[model samples]
Target: MLTLGPERWGGGVIFDPAGYALTVSYVLLDAEIIQVALRDGRRVPATLIGLDLEPGLGVIKLEGEGPWPAAPLGDSSGVAVGDTTATVGVDADNDLVVAQGSVREVRSFAGYWEYMIDRAFIVAPYNPAFGGSPLVNVRGEVIGITSLRLGDRPVVNLAIPIEYFTATKDELISRGRVMSRRPRPWIGVYVFPGDHGVVVGGVSPVGPARQAGFRRGDTIVRINGEQVGSPEEFYRRLWQTPFGEEITLVVLRESRLHVLKVRSADRYRFFRTTGKPPE
Candidate 1:
């Protein structure tokens, strides 16, 4: 078991007969050390192992021997959009509680391996403190790890899909991180929304675009020699090129026409580290 403090914290029961347990990182991220209180109120020291970066999961090792009850981790891939789930965690005072909710939606972003779990028509008894709490099925098998809130609604929570755990647990447990495939080619520029067009603000050093003489503040008028109206269209065009395939970007940078051919890297690397919900 692990928690935020003697007060409010989210933890898990190590259902594994071998004593393995699961929990979320936000509950443990700032924890320099941990202590688990047994059912008998005996407190024992525990150690923080590490976390899963993409899904943001954490695992800890409790000291001393136990006959701790562990919950079986379930296959979340077997879950459907409307399936029912149970979210469990500790409240503000560290009391264990459970709330019932139906799985609402499963959304995956570009390069994301785990789908984000959303719950509808329900709310957690506890607040966002349960960042990595367990979401279980009717069979009491752990299916998801609490992750984030969808949009601006606190009641609408998200979870790191369990499949990512089953697939990467061994790797994470051993290496503390997973090596993702790198994006291969590059246009070498960062783009953002601009009035009436896409604006290039920063350039990647030694990238194809720099080699082609593209400069900052340049407006991208076309990609692949075809006219593009906006940055969205520009990105859409860039994504069309197959991975590792070289493509050309035609743009008017500082009133000069230029073309650059660049290879595309695997996109998965960018997805994991970027755009996570507030902790």
Candidate 2:
């Protein structure tokens, strides 16, 4: 079936016998209305079940008849570099478009959007239209889902390892999100790479950072007494704290160090207060 987002058309895989499907969370963001085009030329309305942003996966359900076609999920842990794989995209005629490629590598991928996938596979020579398309091994069992077009010359692409979904399916179905981990603690400060730490590029108007009197152009030196040297390090340390707790932030503003105590909140909660989309 097809997944048409607010302003774009991407595809998703029906991976469960009960009409539950999967796609990237970005396509599902702010998607108040979604329609699915079946292979038999029938369109079905879909409701978003839930989403897990850590790996950028979204679960959607087709409100239709029973026993839809579902693909078998394979063990992604056994997948290795150099293994042949294929991803299915939608063609101009709205038909399944399958492309073949080889897995180039498996590693962590951190996006500039404050997103991080602990594990992702790099595949080569495949179509980028494979967004949210299932990646199947030679056995035809799905191992991953195409996520991005990293490059073109050598055909590098990225896919979210399937195990992320299989392991959290029940949680998504129940809570609309994973509850195994509490939401990350957020101070609501936008940061950039700095000389020895993350520089505060901007502060959210109503978030903890601004409420605590933090200003722009301040360098984050430490979080709760622990020194941080980079943007990644700062985020990693901040997330380790319990949400809604007060912590001291050591920042250097114009070479003068100031200790500011701020109460952290769930990132999603802050978004709600700011009138931003929860996703």
> TM-scores for all candidates?
0.56, 0.80
Model 2: per-residue Cα lDDT over 1-279, one tens digit each: 122323756778998989998888777755667788887998899888877777888888999787999999899998889999988777546788888988999998766444667789998776757778888899988899888888657667799999999998898877777878777677778788889677887887657888998888999899899998877787788778888899888999888999999998765443211112355
Q: What TM-score number comes out for model 1?
A: 0.56
lDDT of each: 0.59, 0.79
Error of 1 at 102 (Å): 0.6
Error of 2 at 158 (Å): 1.6
Off by over 4 Å in 1: 1-9, 13-15, 37-40, 109-129, 151-154, 179-279
lDDT of 1 by residue, 98-127 (tens): 777767767652212111223212224333
Each candidate structure's count of clashing pairs: 12, 0
Worst 10 residues of 2 by lDDT: 268-277
- Candidate 1, residue 146: CA error in Å? 0.9
Cα error, candidate 1, residue 195 (Å): 7.8
How displaced is residue 42 in candidate 2, in Å?
A: 2.8
Q: Which runs in model 2 stand beyond 4 Å of their true positions?
A: 1-6, 91-95, 151-155, 187-192, 199-219, 250-262, 270-279
Report the Cα lDDT for residue 166, model 2: 94
